[model samples]
Target: MSEQRVASPRTFPTAGEAAFREKVRGLRRWGRWGEDDQRGAVNLVTPEKVREAAGLVRLGLPVSLSRAFPVAPAANNPNPAEHYLRRRVRGEHGEGSVTDYAGVNCHGKATTHLDALCHVWNHDGMWNGRDAAEVVTGDGVTFGGIEQFADGITTRGVLLDVPAFRGASFVEWERQVTGEELDAVARAAGVEVRPGDALVIHSGREAWDRAHPRPWGAPDPDGVYRLPGLHASCLDYFHDSDCGVVVWDMMDAVPNEYGVPHCTHAAIFALGLPLLDNALIEPLAQVCRRESRTDFMLTVAPLPIAGGTGSPVNPIAIL
Candidate 1:
């Protein structure tokens, strides 16, 4: 047997690209907000939506939807975070305090981060069709920067717990979730993932990682990177539901059948939706199950890093 060739992260096969572009064309929101808009679908998060979401906090409980900062290397974290400590030590009586500096390369599988509209792009361009070469400058992004979300993304959030919905402990790497499964999860949970809301999908990626204890995102002996996550078809559901952000434990399944790159991540530009990736949702899942409800007030404030492609984020789900 021979090692399989992986698709270039930036390119797709002829037929695959054609199929993907066509699928995305129908869901595109190029001019829905305005020709000059940079905020994308988050524009749907009106004041009224925030207030309504706030009203759902009956228990006054908040669950963190973020994974702990990856400070040490692990099977999934190859480039661990950078942390430096400075001690003000005249501390004979422990009077002095300690300060630390931290830096992260947060866009990969390990870090819990928020991907801005400019994080990804291709021949179709970025959010609102701005050319990547033009917007993504040498120093920083000129358009659709993470700073555009300075006020934060606060809206109603509902979890679609696939493990609970499918009666499984975790999803298999070979499996891919479709739009129909999402809809079914919503129905089963008795929740409505309305427009301008955060749609959290708990795919049990963290749990799977713990159970398997292997280096995910790294190619296996067969040279294929495989993971369990949503398929491109889920984009149709997103468009139809008009979701503002997609909060997920897992992202696009690796070695996607699409034969295209950024299988589901294309939504960042295609539908102008932000993606909250690598969220740790098992705790949130446990709470939702215990409470018998899934809807909550989801809030996340990205670091005000102007022109950044994305930001390491800690989102909270208030129930």
Candidate 2:
């Protein structure tokens, strides 16, 4: 059996220590930090040595993980309409008038959306410590409001490109990606799963949609949309890491035919890790391929819609 490798505990500098470093650098700066400071203090150390020291200081907890789910007006439109509503009017003074409106059904299973804290409530009637009633309104509500995540999510991201690792461009329809498959993909990627890192799995499911289009909100003939995703063991990996979040390119891990609540969802949610479902990961794949690298600066900012179960996100990556 393969040994289960665990991540070591990590430490980071306190705010005060960071401030002190900034102060010292400012004193030596000829207007900007690190300018004159580098000339004087850095002269004693080579650039590579300085870089090594800076790297140590810069090391923090981990990267944030999140993704933007692409949205369209209709669930299964062959030419899915963008979320733009337009109204036209005829007037004597004006040739024509048009009003644009846009609304999305992000809550639907197929839509790309973040599961708000309220989206799930334990049978015990509490969410992250607050009473479900207190956080939820008469209509239904919860905390860690969508607005709370607007500033942006900060955590580590680990990508397990299942399709690429499998030597297949895409996963076949209705095919369930197993935990073993996920581990194999991680191994192929040369990444050691770590806790606190957002696990992103790309099964090429999104691309499959182009060739095998299905109703947006409806499941495929197999009773579930087939997509590659983390297996049960991957969930254990997340649990061990104490990960703050999990995002995926597929709608969910289990097929609809199974008819039972998704095990992956139940397991992760039980641990309080928020799920970002229906994520767009093709771009991330492109970036990784172009650079021959998997790590990069990933930013995800969800819409600040108070009382909403979930919201659309515009996520970007800076390599």
Candidate 3:
């Protein structure tokens, strides 16, 4: 009988050796993945990597999610000369329009706006950690302001187009959107949500706007402007998942109704989640329609103002 070569004495690593081996293996396993997946992995070596990973672990991850709309303040002509009082200057140079923009209301034309953390205040008056009243100075300036976020936002973004699933034109506001509706939309969009992602909802209102531009100066008839929104329960779901931001096609989470306040705003803002309101959804919808993709890269940069309440954002979606 051929003598079977005896296997070398099985050497068990010592406790220290085993732990060290595990450390090395863990490093290789965690650090070898792609930037997106390794965003929150252990053994993230650099400070930036650590921060990215921590944000992912904290907020889950974001999807490229935002829409661009053409918003003209005053909804008339956005031309500077038209909106602002202009003085014709006669110099060696040809005549030019010098705008006297002292009294124009910037807030009215803030179509692509970010809801600063200070935008909402609980009845008790606490904001983040500081008292709400404290953050807002006597003159109404806020601290830890949205200006801090002016550096273009970068993160994973997810889309949930509920109206698309039903083949409906748009979601009507104040309609008590249910969790079941959300699940159906996810199914239609083929999106699998993870924690910490910015949730963007497209209600098809933009398409409606394109088809029927809100009459230049006509007031939106009562109840004619309603659109679908996240149910109150949906806010609970996102809060539990550690989502950082929510971008919507409409101005609020729920439709504007005579008797109802925006509960979605109350629920989310109370938890420190910033909002991207009145976002344009046409581009996002087009991308979804063309490529059939529900995810992409979303980049939005808000104008940095020292103590401003909110800022207009130029949001871009990279497919």
**CA lDDT scores, all candidates in order:** 0.84, 0.50, 0.50
Point to the candidate with the largest lDDT.
1
Query: For candidate 1, what is the lDDT?
Result: 0.84
lDDT for position 292 in model 1: 91
Q: What stretches of model 1 exceed 4 Å from their correct place?
A: 1-15, 90-94, 221-223
Clashing pairs in 2: 63-155, 63-156, 64-154, 64-155, 195-241
Candidate 3 segments whose C-alpha is farther than 4 A from its true place: 1-110, 138-140, 210-228, 253-260
Ranking by TM-score: 1, 3, 2
Model 3 alpha-carbon miss at residue 2, Å: 91
Reference-based TM-score of each model: 0.93, 0.63, 0.63
Cα lDDT for residue 218, candidate 2? 43
Which candidate leads in TM-score?
Answer: 1
Residue 72 of model 1, lDDT score: 82
Q: Which ten residues in a row have the lowest lDDT in candidate 3?
A: 1-10
User: Model 3: C-alpha RMSD to truth?
Assistant: 19.7
